[model samples]
Target: MSHPVDIHVGRKLKQARTLRRMSQTDVARHLKLSFQQIQKYEIGSNRIAASRLYDLSRILDVPTAYFFEGLGDAPEVGARDHGLDIVSAVASIKDEQVKSRIVTFIEDVSGRTVAKSA
Candidate 1:
């Protein structure tokens, strides 16, 4: 059975894929996996192994810790709330350049807005 962590990881994967305007076929081909495999990963029908998780993190350009950002604990003081809103907002972006710009914008804002978090 897939763990809650696996489900969260899948959600993150799908979010990143949509943010980059990439299709499951595209990501599957890039990762040398089948679209069905990608689907399974995205839906939490199967658990991703550690090596695959590393590959996913590398391919998605997200940190490995992203999958476990707030697992098994309450929110920390001042910890950034990572809601589904950001994922939906990212998925709504149509242009890749716009997405990149948004990412950069977030990075910039995070650098300033949460300076203490650094």
Candidate 2:
């Protein structure tokens, strides 16, 4: 049976992959696994082993803890997809300056203005 944490982590993996604009086949080729395995992992139909998760973190350029970031809330699927969309938008930024501006804008929109670092 699939546990809640597994489902959540799977969603995180999918989100990271999507933001990277990576296909399941690409990830599978990198990890030497079948594309079906990656699909199963994304859907939580198959649990990811710790070693594989570590590999994924490196390949996806996220910390291992990223997969558990919002575990407490157990975000709904729609919320997860929306989060992915936002992450994808941010990841598409090619310039650090532009990305920082977007971050600052988002902070302002959220009513919390954080000072920019020098």
Candidate 3:
């Protein structure tokens, strides 16, 4: 059986990759591994070593801590929240206007104001 921690990490990995708009092949190429290996890692079928995780962090342009976010929470609960991934992806947008527009669109659709940071 796959460990809960491992499954959590895999989901985070996949989430980061998706937020970055990267294919499994793209991430695999950066790590010099096959796409199947990337799939395995994302499915929790294979455990990722520390070095590999570091590499993934760099490739995904996220801090190492990103993978561990919400780890203390129940996996099902954490998995249901895509807010972090959306926020991260939006924050990565270099164009301020585009980011602002996206935030506005989200607020319009959700009918809730997102507090802006100073």
Candidate 4:
């Protein structure tokens, strides 16, 4: 059985990759590994080494700690949570104007006002 931590990390990896709009093939090419290897990593079928994890953090433009975020509260791997995915995708937007507009739109649709960022 895969360790829960491994599964959590794999799920985070997939989340970050998807939020960045990267395909497994793109990540594999950067790591010089086969796409199947990337799939294995994402599925927790194979454990990633620390060095490779560091490389992945760099490639994915996320802090290494990002892979461990919410590990204590994580759900089972492959669980569907579209709300979190949507938040993550919105958070990953680089353009401030676009992000602000999206946030406004979300607030309007939800009938809630989010505090403006200083």
List residue ranges in candidate 2 displaced over 4 A. Answer: 74-81, 85-118
- lDDT, candidate 3, residue 37? 94
Ranking by TM-score: 3, 2, 4, 1
Candidate 1 runs further than 4 Å off: 74-82, 93-118
lDDT of candidate 3 over 1-118, digit per residue (tens): 8887787788888877865557789899999999999998988888889999999999888789888898887656445566756766786788979988987898899997654422
**Alpha-carbon RMSD, each predicted model:** 6.5, 6.7, 7.3, 7.3
Q: Write the per-residue lDDT of candidate 1 for residues 37-100, one digit (tens) a residue.
A: 9999988888888988888777777788877665677767887646457857865778968966
* lDDT, candidate 2, 57-81, per-residue tens: 9888889999989789754676545
Per-candidate local distance difference test: 0.74, 0.81, 0.81, 0.81
Error at 79, model 2, angstroms: 6.1
Model 2 residue pairs with clashes? none
User: What lDDT does model 1 reach?
Assistant: 0.74
Clashes of 1: 0
